[model samples]
Structures are given as structure tokens and as C-alpha cells.
Target: MQSDADGRLTPGGGTDALFWGSLFRDLDREGSFLQLQIRQIIVSAIENGRLPLGARMPSSRDLAAVLKVSRNTIVIAYEQLIDQNFLIARERTGYFVAGLPKHIGAAAREPGGATRDDGRWTSRFAHRPSTYRNIVKPLDWQAHPYPFIFGQFDPGLFPTNDWRESARAALSVPEINNWARDLIDGDDPALIEQLQLQVLPRRGIRARSDEIMITIGAQHALYLIAKLFITPTTRIGVEEPGYPDARNIFGLLTPNVVPLRVDSGGLVLGDEFENCSLVHVTASHQCPTAVVMPLARRHALLQAAQSHGIILIEDDYDGELMPEEGELPPLMSLDRGSSVLYVGSLSKALAPGLRLGYVVAPAPVIRELRALRRLMLRHPPLNNQRVAALFIGLGHYRSHLARVGSVLLERARILDRLLPQHLPHCTWSRGAGSTHYWVSCRPGTDTVKLAELARAQGVVIEPGDVFSIDEGSARHCFRLGFSSIRTERIEAGVERLGKVITQTG
Candidate 1:
């Protein structure tokens, strides 16, 4: 059959007859309308590679005109194709054929029509959904009101210009040897110097360059630690009402996870230490609660770890953002026995996009971590690390941090003042030095439902249940992130969130 310029066969050709026959067959078999038939046609075309990758499909109007069907039917057909991954739509451009899935062997399909030979021999991950988790919903800073996003750093305060200049300088360097290979152990001299001379002393941890190993970020660092320390039956202790991602990671790695209660003083360690070998805690500022670990408890934790020969993984995730005056000493610094493996990151201090973090471990542990780092992705991007080191070495990092601290401190104060006006029944505690505020809701409030209502109104807030290890407590509490949004939006976001709480209650 001779095809026209638009790839459609002429009326005299067999194309029209074939199309009509296929449509009739599909309609007779499924009793579906024209839209469903069109959908099946497009799907079959994609599957058979007749509509190749990146090839633009006919527009709804054009397809409807050609097929003598309603435009709405074509639109619905296109929508189904987009949803099924048979087609992709660019923002302004029209829809195009999406990439095809990999082909499997015939053995994968059984005579009974099952993908596997036997249902009893199914893959462990067969039942899991193949959809990506949406991290954040679309947020309207002004209209929707209450915003409680976690790990949000104030963008207005970051030294964007200085960082750009630093990055440019690092890129402009004539010699770029490290870029070719991964510095798994992160042996960049400048970065090591900054860690030893600048960061460690500031945090009261005394560590040499040989003890530090850089990773992609704190998440990666935590993952490597889990791989090294945890096994299926290994007992691990994590702080109660702690970072959810950390809990999830540990849970996936090991079966025996002990939930240590966290109070105003930080991790409440009792006789549980006898059964646990590895403990994870945010000593600088406990997440969700924002409580600083007191000196007595810090010493007690170090002592417990030392006496039991346990390894304490100190996650100082947001330690650098603490205010100058009242910041407590890191647990690693308090460890005179060298039992703590300190993990620090620049995600909150600088930006999460940076993906820069360092682990200060003992000499032996550093060797094992380096091997694992090599096995993972080799190392983090060398140029990025080099620039980060340069930024830190040139005093720009400290200046930027000072700027961030001042801005977030001011924002925190604003949140404290405005939250009461909108949410009078809700009570907020003063944070030691961080971007978030942990608020206690009214006696009978449901934080999850409140979060849902806030999302419906176009604001994204994290419910307290994700952080709490104990049940029933999260219903009355939720965390508010004040770092990312503008100062003007803070009051309004809180106001909207307050309305959701009031209505839900």
C-alpha cells in the first residue's frame, strides 16, 4: 500500500480497511467505545515499534479528523497512552513515543499465563509497586498558608554569588586529574585540611586527616555504615522520634532494631545497651524535637558505648547550622575512648544539592569504609569536592554559614511569634539552633489529617507520625520547616496550616 506524506495510507490502499477491521475486532471483543479502540491501536503500535522512539504522534485534532471520531475520544486515548508509558508529552511540544521496555526470554512466561514458571517460585520483589515516591507536593507559598517541609534550608540567605565564583574558579583550573578517577577515600588535601583545622575544632572533635573519608552525602555515609555494622539479626538502637530516613535504612538492612526513647535531654539510654552493639543518635540537635544533648547524658552515652564495646554512629546532620552561643559539644568530641564514628554533612549548612559529607572514623574503620566507597560509586564528583574544599579553605564557607545562621535564626523567631496568633491552642518549643520547629498540637488533633487538608489547600507539611517510633503520640504533634520559604510566606503558611488543624479538630 502506498502511504501519504503524513504516513497514513491512501483511501484506495488497504490501510483504511485494515484500520476499520482492527477497530471492529477490538470493539466486538471488548465492547469498548472508539477511544478504547484508539488506545489499543496506539499501544500495539508502540509495542511493535511501528511508532519508534522519540517519534511524534498525531495531534488529537488531526487524529480525530482522520479517524472520524470526537476530539474528546482522541484526547482520552492520548491520556491513556501517556499514563501507560506508551507515549510522552513535552511541555509545549506534542506527544512522542516513549522508550520501550526490555524484552525477556520465553522461559519467563509460563503456559498458565503467569510471568513465572510457578507461582511458588516468584521473585521476592514481584509484588512491589513500580512507581516512584513523590517526595513533595506542589506548594503555593502565599495562598495555601501553612508549610511544614522537613530539611528546608533558607535559599534567600545562601551565598549564591560566592559559591558560583568558587565553582568557576575550580572549573577553570588547568589541571583536572582527580576528575578522571574517584577519590573513594576523599584524599583531597584541601578538604582534609579544612576538616581537621576548621570543622573539627569548631565542633570540639579532634581528628586528623587520615581518619576522615568523604562520601556522596550523609545518606550514603549512613548506608555504608549499615553495610559494615548491621546484619539480619544484629541488634541496633536508633533515637526515638528521630530522622525517618535513617530508621528506614536500618530497618531494611537489619531485623533487630531497638527503639531507644528520646526525651528533652536527648537519647534515653538505659539497660538496652547490653543487647545492642550499634547505636545511632543525633547528638547536636535531635531531629523532630530539636533538643540538644546535655553534657551529663553525652558523657553517659560515651561511657555506655565504651564499657560495652559498642559503636556509636553520631549523625551530626545539621550540626553546622547551630547558633554560636548555646551549641553543645558533639558526642564524638566527648568520646575520649575513640568509640564514636562521627558523620557530618553540609546538606543543611550549605545546600542538600551539594551532596558533600565526611565521616571521621578510626584508622581501621576508615580502611573498610574506603573499600566500600570504591565498591559503591568509586567516589563523589571530584570537581565538586575540590570546589567545596576551596570554598571552605578560602573562608567563604564560614562567611556563608554565618549568613545562613543569622537568616534562619530570624526566621525561627518569626515562626515562633506568628504560630501562636494563628494556632493559639498549639504550643511550640524554642529550638536550640536549627531550621525546623516541633509543635505540639491541641489535645485531640490529628496531624496526619491536618497534613492532608494542608496539602489539599496547596501547602506541604510533614506529619509527626513519620518521626515517632512510639504509636499514639504523633497524632498530637507535627514538625514545621521554616528554612526554605520567604519570610513573608511564613506567617501566611502557618495561618493556612492553623485553619486546617482547626477544621480537622
Candidate 2:
């Protein structure tokens, strides 16, 4: 069966019934009635080589007409295939068959009318060791509006000329030849000194050159810390609705990942830490919720860590991106007990592509982390670190930050105004000082559906589910990032997203 010029399926060639009827039989075995039928047909076609790998499928409307079904059915079928990895959809070019399955062909068919469970039998990943990939799906950013994509800087506003100059200068350095073998646990002393002088003071963190270790980025830093501190059964307290990457890292290293609740002030520390040996916190600006840990709570956290002999991994990932309010003291600044391990990154302030971050810990822990880092990637690339240090030491870094900060403030203002107009039912909370806003929608609203609708309108928003520890309460909130896109885009994006919510309601 093929589609005619008018976009209707015509049963033309011989064996048309055999081709079409086989699809129907397969659909009968599939549970879902409407879309599943279309999906089954597509899957069978791909499996049988009728639609080869990378072959474009008919448009949804044309296929719907051919199959005597509604366009909605075809759309849902296509969406299912896209979700299940059975097909790949190009934005405007329709769907194409994905790579061929390893099984489910003539080889799996029994001549005596017996059928084998080809999918189950031929799976190569069945016994693979458990890893983070199984728990986390690559976030689909295209499906929401104002998605607070973590760790992305405002690319349009970045100081490209300044960066180019610094990079070129660094490449031209006579000592650059040593960079090939300089990939090790410690970074350049000049870079470490620059971090100690330029970055730590703003957050009230005091560290010497010997205490800081450079890593690829905050994620890499967190991974190395987890490897060093977390044992298989160690109970690590993580903030509920926290950074997923942090939680995922700790989860992979240790089975006992404790979820600590948070409120307006910050982490609600109770007796949960009695048995917990380690804690990971985004103290500067809490991820997703964007709450800055209050000074009292910071002290309480520090006291708890000291009293319990626990380690505190303070991830100041986006500290510098915090809007200009009086500087909020980092945990390390107030940490008199030498228990806080402070990790900061330039990824958010500069650009994530740089992949440069540093961790300041006690001399002992720093030594252990360095050993672990050697086991991991040996060290981060030295050239970026040297150039970044040069940029900061020469004052170019601060200038770039000032420019980006101004743009972020303007964008944040635009978002604050536009959000209320577009989403009247939602309320926005400003953090102590951060790049994004935490938006709480009206109770009983489905943020997942809201995300879907926004996605349909070309706005990528981050749903609250990724941040929630209990998953059940994540549907009423979402995060909006104002630092990455242009200020003008914020208004239009919010307006378009608002239309989705209004129409859905």
C-alpha cells in the first residue's frame, strides 16, 4: 500500500493485503488502540527493511489518511516512536527510520510456527553494570519554555573579542610546549593564586594556593569528591529538589543517598544527618529553587558537620552569576572547623565550554582528592586554566563579568515583569542572588503538561520533576532561566508559554 498524489493510501500492487494485514495483526498484539497501531506499523516496517535505516516516512497527515486514522493518532504514534528510539524526527522533514534492530527478523522466526522473544533474547545491554545513564535521560530542552538549562552562560553577551585575544596570546606563549604533559592533578600555580586572590574573597572563602585543585568543571569536581568521600553504603545528605547531576553523582557512588528537605531559608536540617557521613549543597544559589542558604543555616550546617564528623561539599557552581546584592558568605568563609570543601566554577559566569572549575578543601582532603583525580583523568587541560588565570589576573575577566552581569540584570527584570503578565496564576521568587527565578504555578496545575504545551510552541522550559526528591509534588513548579538568552527573547518566550497554559486551562 502506497500513498497517492492526493495523499491517500492506494492499495495498488500485489501482496498489498499481505503487507497491510501484517501490520494490523501486529497492532492487534499491541495494547494501545489508536497510536499504537500506527507505531506498530512503523516498527514492523523498519524491522522488515521495508523502511530502511534513515529512510524518511510519510508525513503524519498523509500517513493518517492512508491508514484511515485521525491526524492526532498519527502524531501520537510518531511521538511514541520518537520517544522509544524507533524513529528520529527532523524538525521540518518528517520522521525517518532509526537504525535497524539487531533482532526480530527472519532469523528469529521459527519454521514450525514457534516465535522467540527476540527483543529479550538479543539484548546486549541486559547484563551491563548499573550506571548513571540508566537513571537519567538526556534532558530534552526543546520541550519547554525558558528551560533553566544548568551551567549555560549567556552566549550572545559573552566577551568573545576578549576571550579570543586571551586564547591567541596563550597559544603564542613560549612555555606552551609543556602543556602536553602538564595534564595532572594540580593546575598552574599562577591560576591557583589568581583564584585565591580574585574569586575566593568575594564569597568570603579564604584559601591559599596549596588548598585549591582544578578540575574540568563543577560536575567533574563533584564526581571526584564523591569518589573520594563516598563509600558504597555511605549516607550522603543531598538537598531535596537539588541539582540532579549532584544527586546522580552521589547516587552512583553510594547507595544511601539521603534527601534533605528545603524551605525558603534553605536546607531543613534535622536529625537526618546523624548517620550521614557527607553532604552536598549548592550553598550560593540552590539549584532549581535558587534559594541561598541563610547565614544561620550555614553555621548550623557547619556545626552539624563538625559535630557529626561529616564532610560538607559546598558546590558554589554559579556563585559569581548571583545578582549584585551584598555578597553572601560562602560556607568555607564561616567554616572555622576546616570541614568544608568549597568547589567553585567559572562555567556559568564565563562559558561552560571552558570546562574550568576549582575546589578548595582542607590540606588532607585536598591531597586525597588529588590522588583520586589522578585515578580519574589525571588532570584538566592546563592551557585553558593558564589563559583563564591570565584573563582574571589582567582584569579582562572582571570586565566580561560586569558586562554579562548587566545584561543578566536587564533580562531578569524583563522576566519578572513578563512572567506576571503571561502567567498571572504563577508567582516568582527572587533568590539571594542568582541567574534564574523559581516559579511556583497555581496549585493543582500540571507542570509536565505545561512543559509539553510550551514545547509545542518552541519554548524549552525545565519542569520541576527533575529537581524534586519526591517527584509527586514537582508538577506545580518550574524554573525560568534569564541569563542564557537575550532580554527581548524573554518577553516573547514568556508570552508564548503563557498562551500554552491559558489554552490548556
Candidate 3:
């Protein structure tokens, strides 16, 4: 078929080719299979009455020739549509549009109209979570030349083959039987077993299966912990430049959330611990700052918590990816009095979209959390749990971590070399084995503005002010993440960013 003057398809001197080629003009040929695309087009046309009920469809061969797809593609699409009751096939004749269900046909035929109502949604809402400040990253970060964004994956480093192998293994008959059922208030035993055997020992954590509960993510674990423990009057101490989500979660329940100071070590042990009943700390690597808590500091924080009779929530995010020299035992591993509740996730090393995390606490605490979780979500998807379990059990998890760690280490080293030459006016944190650097630009430098200008030049960096409760403290600071950027592009991207900073300053 060939297009006429009005951009509609016309048959090339043959009436056999259908003029319906206008429908497939905008087809997304690159996205999915041609067969599925054909089915979608036909279904949409029928539902919208463009192809009315009992309307004859183009023959598979003629339609395939017009669309430049294989004849088998159209045939399979037609057969599938016929099976689904969207189309009817005759032995010798072409397919016809099948009658749709009453609701579907009526809705498709009806014109959409806006609902009439007063604008009382704001008054009805009990809380306005949207007013809170959040750490926002560009949705198109991948399209940029330099995406120095934190907690995002490098597509190149993902273990595609290994993950696929595990996913395929999880789909087997026996594996499906194991994970297909609902487990109210319970996790996949295989995942729990894998966590106990292959995961927790690295952090010196040893816990019974009863003491562990799988969560949708670390945020979910924190939410459950907060719901179970936090009251409006409870005093919760959080690190000054700590995780924003944790701060926000606690703030939702209590007005007595206190900001604890952080130095070169981690959360400073002081009078702040004395007043707060609960404290949240990122022991392994502090968020935004990427500061690793020292052994002495970790010991001091634990002692202070004990002396003050305070419970501690330790979020050990990205700790598993720490270099051998930089690795420190988690607070949960050292707690003899059961004062620490440890939260860990595969998000930092694995993909964030997976949203798999676990909470390790006392048995009673875990039991309560499980009950609370059941009320909310029943349980994290069992299939994902099974796949993760298989991924770990097959030894792919450790190997993937090793490979990713090597790449990140190399990228970090590149940033280490490039930053001094390009941006000498800025000082940065020297947290070993960190995927990002917390940088303090020259005095009076507005990093938020700098970031905006830098983005115009294809460089992306995160401002540090959002991490701090007191915005003035981090006004001149920013964070540079090396995880998602390519190694060769690092030097040029940094050089460009330095020029922007200089010109803007």
C-alpha cells in the first residue's frame, strides 16, 4: 500500500489491501511484538466503533502486506482476539468484530464529561503530605550526559543474564506451587532462609527466623516500626542531616521529633539521646553525607542509648556493598540488650524498583510488625521473594555485588582524581566505599541555582539542603553520585560542571 496526498494509506492498484492503514500509522514498532500491536489496534478500533459490530476485518495476508509485517503475525493476532471474544473468525472468510459486553460498549460509546462538585477536597483531607519537601530527581536522568544522582542504578551494571536465570527458575512447576499461595502475616520461608544463610552474616547479624520479617522496602519497615512504637508524645531523635523519609515518617506520628547533631563520625552521642525515647540512625553510611560511623562512635552511641534507656532503629542501607576495609559491624550485631532494630535493603546494590527489604528485631517486635503489615498489604509479593531467594541461593547475588562494587569503586576513584583538578574551591567528604560524595562548594555558592544551570549543560547534581532540617546548614553544599555515570564521561562531565560553577559564582 502507498499513502495518498492526505497521508492516508491507499492500495497500490489493488483493492484487496484495506484502507485501514491509517490506524497503524502511529504503531509503536520498536516497543513490543508486532502481533500484540496488531491485536491492540484492532481491539481499540472495535471498542471505539471505528470498526462497527459485524464489520469485516482485512484478510491476514493483505493486512500484513500493507503493514509490512509477516502474514503469520496478523493470523496469530486474529486468532488470539477470536479466543478473547473481541473478534470472530470464519473458516473461509475474514474476521468480524464481535459484540462487546454491555458495559464496555456503553462506556466506549459515551462521551467523557467532568464531574460537577464543590472544591472541598482540601477541607476533607486529614493531612497534607504534599506540603512536605522531598528529595526529587529528574525522571529523565538517564537521558543526561552526566547523571550524578544518588540511589539510581547503572543500567550497564545490572546482571541481566543472572536475574533472568533466577526469574525463569522461579516459574517452574514446583517453584510456582511454593509461592502461588497467600501467606497471611508470613514471608516466604525460602527468602527468610536465604537471608539467614547468605545475607546477614556479613554484618555479623545472627537472628532466628521468627525475628525477621520481609517488607516491601526499608521505607515500609520504617513505617511499620513507627506505627507500632511512635505516639504523638513520643520523643524521636533523628540525625540532623539524616534520611528525609525517616524524618517525615516519624513526624507524621509525633511532634517531638528532635534533630541530633552529626560530625565526621555519625550521630553525636549527647544530651539529645537523653530526652528522646526512640532514635533513628544510619550506622553504616549516613544518607546524603555518606559518613561511616566509626567503631568507637558506634560503641559510644550504643552505650548512650543503653544509658538513656532508648530504642535505636538502625538503617544499614548500602552497607553490604562496603569495601572490606570500610566494613564495620552493625549495631544489631553488637546489641546484647536488644536495643537496636536493624533495617536493611537490596535497593542500594540491587535495583530500587525491586523494593525488597527486611527488618531484624526481637521476635515479639517482628510478630507485631507482621500483624500490622498483614492489615496493610498481607505480605510482599511471594513471587518476587522466591526470585530473590533463588538469586541469592544460586550465588548470583554475591557475584553481582562483587562486580558492581568493583565498577563503583573505579568510578569513585575517577571522581576523586577529577574533583581536585576541576573544582578546587569545593571541599567534600572522604567517606570510604561510598557511591556519592557530599561536597561543600565555596562560601555563598547557591548549589540549587548551580544545579539548575549545570543541568542545562547536561550535568545533574543533587543539592544537599533537602537532607538537613536546617536548610542554612547545607545551602552551599551538594552531592555528586558516581554510581550511574559512565567512567569515561566522568572527567568531561565534571569539567563542564566546574566551568558552570565558576561562571555562576
> Considering every candidate listed, which one attains the maximal lDDT?
3
lDDT of 2 by residue, 311-358 (tens): 888888778765577547888888889888888888778887888888
Error of 3 at 290 (Å): 0.6
TM-score of each: 0.73, 0.72, 0.90
Judged by lDDT against the true structure, how good is candidate 3? 0.86
Lowest-sum lDDT 10-residue window in model 3: 7-16
Alpha-carbon deviation at 304 in model 1, angstroms? 1.8
**Predicted model with the maximum TM-score:** 3
Alpha-carbon deviation at 34 in model 3, angstroms: 4.5
In candidate 1 the C-alpha lDDT for residue 310 amounts to: 87
lDDT of every predicted structure (CA atoms): 0.75, 0.75, 0.86
Model 3, span 51-117: residue lDDT tens: 6666677778778878888899889998999999988877875577786776888788987646634
How far is each candidate from the true structure, as Cα RMSD in Å? 10.3, 12.7, 3.7
Candidate 1 runs further than 4 Å off = 1-122, 126-146, 173-175, 182-186
Candidate 3: which pairs clash? Answer: none
Sliding window of 10 residues with minimal summed lDDT for model 2 = 129-138
